[model samples]
Target: MSMDLFSIARSGILAAQSQLGVTSNNIANVNTEGYHRQVAIQGTSTSMRLGNNFYGTGTYVQEVKRIYNDYAARELRIGQTGLSAAEASYTKLSELDQLFSQIGKAVPASLNDFFSGLNSLADLPSDLGIRGSVLNSASQLAQNLNQMQSHLSGQVQQTNDQIESITTRINEISKEMAQINLELMKTPGNDAQLLDKQDALIQELSQYAEVNVIPLENGARSIMLGSSFMLVSGEVAMTMGVTTGDPFPNEPELTYSLGGSELKADPAKLGGQLGALFDFRDNTLMPASHELGQLALGIADAFNEMQSQGFDLNGELGQPIFTDINDPVIAAGRVGAYSGNPGTASLSVNIDDVGALSGSSYELNYTSAGTYELKDMKTGAVTNLTLNGNTLEGANGFSINIDAGAMAAGDRFEIRPTANAAANIGVVMSDPKGIAAAAPKITAGTGNSGSTSVKLVSIDDRSAANFPVTDSELTFTLDTSVNPPTYEVFDVNGASLATGTAAGTPPQISAFGFTFEVDGSSGGSESFTFDLSFAPGDNTNAVAMAKLSDSKIMNNGKSTLGDVFEKTKLDIGSQTKSAQVRAGSAEAIYNQAYARVQSESGVNLDEEAANLMQFQQAYQASARIMTTANTLFDTLFSSVR
Candidate 1:
């Protein structure tokens, strides 16, 4: 009987010790991150039946179980992913927004000054000083645009660098998580510290990307990204690599391997810092840079057109004032096929019309054998392209020429017609006298050739279709024998556009982009000649060019040059504001989800303190039982003696 009592007491004491150890451990790690509260499970030992009466033995400690709600923890990780993505996007966009704010101060101001100089030159067409000022202003404007483009290019490189850094960190974390998982597999359950480390690493990983954890055998988990692509599985971790579509590396592309199959993942859908970086590059920076390029192209093209219609001081046709602004940017895809002897295909794109430019990038894909498809990156509109020999035309306002080799199926190219136009723009006119401030030729006629008083009215070239003619000589022959004094008009090509009688309230005649007036004529053979010459004081074309400031030449003929810049600014502001609002909302949701997790798994000091006192008393009671049993044994022995 005494030995039975001792056995029961000894078991009770061991059970109480375990309970105390678990409670104390919970208290010790209460403030530790990812630490789950633990409880020591207890069960009664086998009982003995004596005389049909059951006798109770002491309790034994089972195992210590962690109080972790798996569902709540998963929810927290998901919410944290969203919050981190929003925060990352907002942070990057804010930096972009600040950079774009300088647009008004730099490019717009320089453009305004350039145009103002042109207006001044128009007022004083023969002033050499004003011509020099115009040239200087143009140089200044081009310099400013180049500077801004350079800054934006640097930003792109900086963004790529950030992506590289983030990817490196993600790889490190994945490797550590895999290592922890492998360690966990060895001991399985009862490894609380290892589990804590694993959970903490997963949470940290979620800060960089959206991740999902799948429970595997032996208390190990596999971390996944975007519903697929395991980042860390069991004892192995897969690494993501960054590849740029272009050599400049404006946008970062993600690549990974699964079962020896390489696949590309869209960074925008990935979530977290990596996703946000891609979003900023593709959605914000690329478009804004292209718009700036569009503006540069528009300005350069319009001014050059007007310049071509004018004559310089040397009586020569005006050369291009600025270098080419219509060059396209080409990017080769990482995945493509090459064939033939040359093996490589070269594409050259040139803008056909500024008014018809879509201000968007295009993807040229060799879909199948002998077939090509073009997709607008902005609108996702696909157009079937016809290959006309080496050149592909009739798309948007541009043409692409495959200058070399043969393009194989599955080959892809990114064509940006105006994305870098501003960066490459320069003032090609070195001499101020090269500026075209005069019309190619002034309207002139033989003064009073016949009895009819003939005078040059006004040349109207303000119409979009009515452009100034580059004529060296035009002849107008008058026959005054008729009652109304009929006259025949001929252009520089000697083509008669108007003949017979002049009919109008002002008795005007229109021909060769000009109108003529005649009054009081009689029967006589008269001839008039309009000659084109380099007149230093001619400002006809200059005046016409100045009016282009109000013309709808951008946004598919819906907005002017100034309007495009204004719209770009507004777009940046709107995107930044939207990101900020989303970030706030995401933070709120993450907080709620995290609070739920904390409530389920977090340790409570008050409860642990109460448990500590209760366990201590239970331990003392078990010790007292052993003491009483020892005293009874001693008393029995003494009585027997």
Candidate 2:
């Protein structure tokens, strides 16, 4: 009995001490991230038998375990992933939104300044300085737009860097978790320290990707990312790429592939930070930048055309207005003689002098012996002209065209004619918006409210049969929607269309010297532009260039530039709001799961204190047993003496 008592006292003391340690650990890690409170599980010892009678031994320690709910842990992990994605998306886009707000300031009053310079010239029609200033402003605005674009592009590059860095971080975490999981398997059943390490790692992981947990028989964990396991059987470890070469997709396309199998996930359908980046590039940034380009082009074309038509200080016709579009290469193209001749020559057509433009007329020529016939680029037709004393004379009033296809990259055209010619030619450009004469004032709608008031803005000759000549359909583009809208098109001579919306499955339109099918449809109508140029003899009273500049041609007499920018800003706002809402919902779900899991698995101060009391009491009872055993042994030894 004494022996049994001594053994029981010894075991109870050890068990109580272990329980106290566990409870202490629980209290210590209460505020620790990813810490799961532990429990000291105890079980009764086996009954000791001697002869027919049986006697029970004292209680013994069974195991030290975590009070975690696996289900809750899984839910918490998934929620964390979604929340991380949302926050990341919001932060990045907000930065971009702030950047875009500086557009107007960076290129302050571009069109206004250009026109103001013109007004100055109109006052002093023969001032070279003013003429040069006007040209400078026009070119300067173009440069400003180019600079702004460069800045936006830099932002895009930075986003790519962030995405790649994040991916690489995710991979690092995955590899560490995998390695830790293996080490844990060998470290005697559920090492609390190791468990804490792994849980901490997983929680950190929630910041990047969505995760799924798999529990093994030995309390080890493996993880999955949206169905495909990122970790498996405590092995086959994978490292995620936090950084990649180009993280931001230029066109913002999203696709998922598994062993060459492309998954059907529209980037829009994804609900994470990654998805937000895709949406920004695809729907917001890309679209806005292109529109910015269009705005720059429109202003350049309009102002340049007007300036070229007006007289400089020398009363010479200005050069063709700035290009409808330009590139790094365009600035290099020299204003030169349009004659087909290989030898150098000069042009004296200065349309800038209003009086001269009123009666200005000439032709161009390019021949093997000298400058004679040059093709008009605008019309891609031949121009006829005769050169005399550095001045050019032509038939047909000097209307000419230059063909893009006919010219080579380095081909040069000499405008002054001589190596050091004294005279030069005027500017040539066509206005697409038709805003030269009118400052503001869109014509009021005579049609019904639902009737679209879309006016033609511009169109390139991308092809003969294709309407609007662009990738995306415009209002003027023929529609093949199952129920097509009934609208009038000036180019197709008022042709109407109707058909199913499926692309290439067509009922078609036959007009504009070509028969083309109506394919695909959109929720809203599109728009296009047409050329209605103003000329001197055409009558200022008629549909002349000056007449269109009237306030009536615009929306509420506001600059077209203002209208276009405002519309685009509204669209971008909606997209950002949508992202915020989605992210909020995800966060709410994560919080709910986290709380539930914390209730079961998280440390509790009061609970730990109470456990300390219970274990201490058990230890006291065991100490009493030891004292009793010693007393009995002392008595037995005294009897032997």
Candidate 3:
């Protein structure tokens, strides 16, 4: 009986020792990250039967189990991913917003200053200083646009660098995960520390891209991005790579592979920092850059065309005020073929309607044999086109002419008409004397015997006007036989053109490039003559240039230049604000998930301390039983002797 008591006391002592060790371990690692609380479970030992009665044999310790909730872990990962994406998006968008909010030398401000300079020139049409101011303002505006485009390009490059860096980190993590999977398969479900490390690694990976973890047999896990872009499966890890050889100011394409087979996954499927960066680069930054280029191109082309129609102070046809894109298509106005494009077709594009242009890039690809597809990168709208002998007419507000080459199957092209206009624009006319501020001259002839006076109005159509090779004279002969004196028009050769009863109205002249207004009536049998001559001091062209500030010349003439810029600013502001709000919400959700994990698996020092005391007392009692059993056994032996 005493022997049986010794066996019972021994089991109690061992069970207490194990429980105490577990309690101590919990207290020690209370501050350790990713460490779940552990508990030592004890069960009753096998019974000993004597005389048909079963009795317990102290206790046996089961496995030390770590407290973990897989659902909470998943929620925590998702929340953290959301927070990371939102924060990344907010950071980039805020930078863009601040960039557009330039204090004085911003694009909009420079544009306004340019118009103001034009208005000043209109007030003093012949002043050289004012003309110089106008020229300087134009130059400054072009400089401002150039600076903006350069900055945006820099940002794009920076974002791409970050993307490559992030991808590298993700690859490293995935490789580690594969290594861990191999290690775990050797001793499945025994390495609690290894499991903890794997969870931590997964959390880190989620910051760069969406992660989905699937537990397989043998306690191994597979890491996937988006839906099926597996990073790791069993002991294999897929590698990620970035493709290069594209032009500057554009991001390289992303590539994925498993072992050695190349894989393609849509970037949109990603959801963390990687996804946010891709979205900012493609959706926000690219479009905004293209829109700015569009504005610059539109302004330059419009002003240059107007200046061409007028005469400078030197009485010569004005030169181009701004150098525009050479062919109004492709990035930097240069044709682009896909890096691996299977085509030799060279493309040229013309802007049929500037106002109809949208701030978007396009993708041109061959759908099949002798067929092409045009897609708007921003909207994903597709337009089908037949080959039509290498000309695509009236598509997307532009005409595409393909020449001197043939296309192979699966060829692709990228067209960014307005993406680099700002960078390419320049002040072509350096001389202030080249600024056109005068119109064709008109004058009234010296010989007239009537109360009627004539003044020259605008020459609406300069191309159709038949200006005489030499000075031409227009004579108005009147007849007082009618109540309202009738008049007959005669050219320089006295050839009668038209005869009509005169009234108080302006009459358009077919011979000259102008119209005339007669305020007073002609006397009986009187004659009036007028001639057209050059006018160097005219401000009509300058005034017309100044009016472009308020003209609806963008968005199919539905928006002004200022309106497009304002919309851009507002869009950036709205995106920044939305990202901030989403970040806040995601942070809150992450905190809550963390709290849930903590409540379920976190160690409690006070509770561990209490457990320590209980186990200590139990240990002491079991030791006392051993002592008592030993003493009783010694007494029995002495009595028997």
Candidate 4:
């Protein structure tokens, strides 16, 4: 009986000791990551033989379990992932802030300065010094654009390299994770080290791109990239690659096809740090460079074309500010380039707006296989061309393109038929055609009416003046004295040509396609009237009577003839000002999210210390039971002796 009693006491003591041990362990490892508090479970042992009443064996350990909620663990993972993405996005976006902050002197600043210089020139229209200043400033503006374009192109190249590096990293990590799963499947239990390593890897991977992770039966996780690349599956990894910057400024883009395989945007998916960088390079930085290029190209085209009309300074015009892209379509399409012409009117190429063009001229020359390239003179960024066009419902310039997808917002462009020389007309039309013979597109009627007639001397058909490139033109000339007189040059249909004054000097003559220059006449505001004309689609006008005293001009100073040239210049300084503000806001949001997540997951030593006390008391109580059991056994032995 005494032995039986001792056995019961001993069992109780052992059970209590086990409970204490569990509590102590929990307190000790409170700071250990991924360690859930464990509890020792005790149960009554069964009797070997049952008679009247079955009250037999003492106690036995049932199972060692965790004092954790399964639901809580799942919640933690969900939150962890959310935080991971936020943190990753924030980290990646931070780089954009840095990049934008660094984009100086060439972008917005130069743009604004360029226009301001134009304003100064307009203020002193006849100041030779100011004129030189205007030219120099214009040239400087182009230089800034070129630099900016080059910078953006560089950024694109860097982004592509990053994409490659990111893909490689993801691939390696994915394979490692896959292997871990296989090893885990063969093993009896989970390997904590593998789990931690996988977690660390996931955190790292999230920085570059967003990912979807699925846990397999074997304790392994499968990784996918942007629903595109199945980076890792069943212990295998598929890698990704990238093509660097475009070498041609006017071309579109080329994808980094994976060794002649499909374009892998998955492992190379544009997201996380990669996405922000891509956006900056393509959307922000790249576009800015392109705009700079556009501005440069536009001004160059304008000034060079005008130089043929004879300006104030140099005997001849200088070279184009930036180099043209190597593409035949540029000189072939609606916005085709013009070389030389002796006609009184020369060609004028005026872009409707810079925002209207694709990232570069390459979109017009997208390759059949959907591979094309264009160099960014600013950031030197290169990107793959998705799609684009100069007109709505535009054709698939490249066969592998979506049909006139969506026009990017802020886009603007137009190709008005222009003349070739200062006094040369480049409109392919020599006269109205096909509609009414011996009739004109526009006719002049005497009155207070603003009707001006367009006369095409050698009419092609004289019927359909409602067109461009038909070789029909109005004959005109310029004066070189004070300044060129402003003339409203009209088309065959009496529609305005791209706005500018008629040539102002050297009394040049043209049989066809001469540029409109200013007339050096009474007050430099002469209006040369044309004869009867018809047909439509012309939109050119003289520098619409630029009067500084006009209240409209003083209020905003834009959209008018005088301010037209000024409006088109770059605005680098203004752009930078706004970019800095945007960067600041993004930074704040990132920091806040980061702080909130850390507070919840981090360890607190003070809380653990408090838990230690409770476990110590339990330990002491269990020790007393062991002493009582031994004492009882000794007393029984003494009696028997």
Model 2: per-residue Cα lDDT at residue 542:
17
TM-score leaderboard ranking: 3, 1, 2, 4
* Candidate 2 per-residue lDDT over residues 1-641, each given as its tens digit: 98899988988998999999999988888888888888888888888999999987877889888777767877887788788777766676666666656663455465556656656644544444654675676566666666666766776777666656655676677678777878877776777777778887877766655566787755578876555434344754654332121212242232333454543334344334555565565445655654454355444444554533332222122344555323223322223433234433322322111111111112233444445664533245565556443434553322223422333222335321111000111223222112232211122223323333322222222354433322322223323233543333543243433222312223443333223333334434533332222232222221233222332322223445444445556655665676689789988999999889888988778888999999999889999999999999999999999
Global lDDT for candidate 1?
0.77
* Candidate no. 1 TM-score: 0.81
Candidate 2 colliding pairs, count: 69
TM-score of 2: 0.60
The candidates, ranked best first by lDDT, are: 3, 1, 2, 4
Model 2, residue 528: distance off in Å is: 26
TM-score of each: 0.81, 0.60, 0.83, 0.55
Q: Candidate 2, after superposition: displacement of residue 166 in Å? A: 1.0
Candidate 3 segments exceeding 4 Å error: 103-105, 245-249, 327-335, 368-371, 384-391, 441-533, 637-641
- Worst lDDT 10-window in candidate 2: 416-425
**Local error of candidate 1 at residue 462 (angstroms):** 26
Better of 1 and 4 by lDDT: 1
The per-residue C-alpha lDDT of model 1 at residue 15 equals 89
Error of 4 at 140 (Å): 2.8
Q: Is candidate 2 or candidate 3 better by lDDT?
A: 3
Error of 1 at 531 (Å): 5.2
Better of 1 and 3 by TM-score: 3
Candidate 4 local Cα displacement, residue 368, angstroms: 12
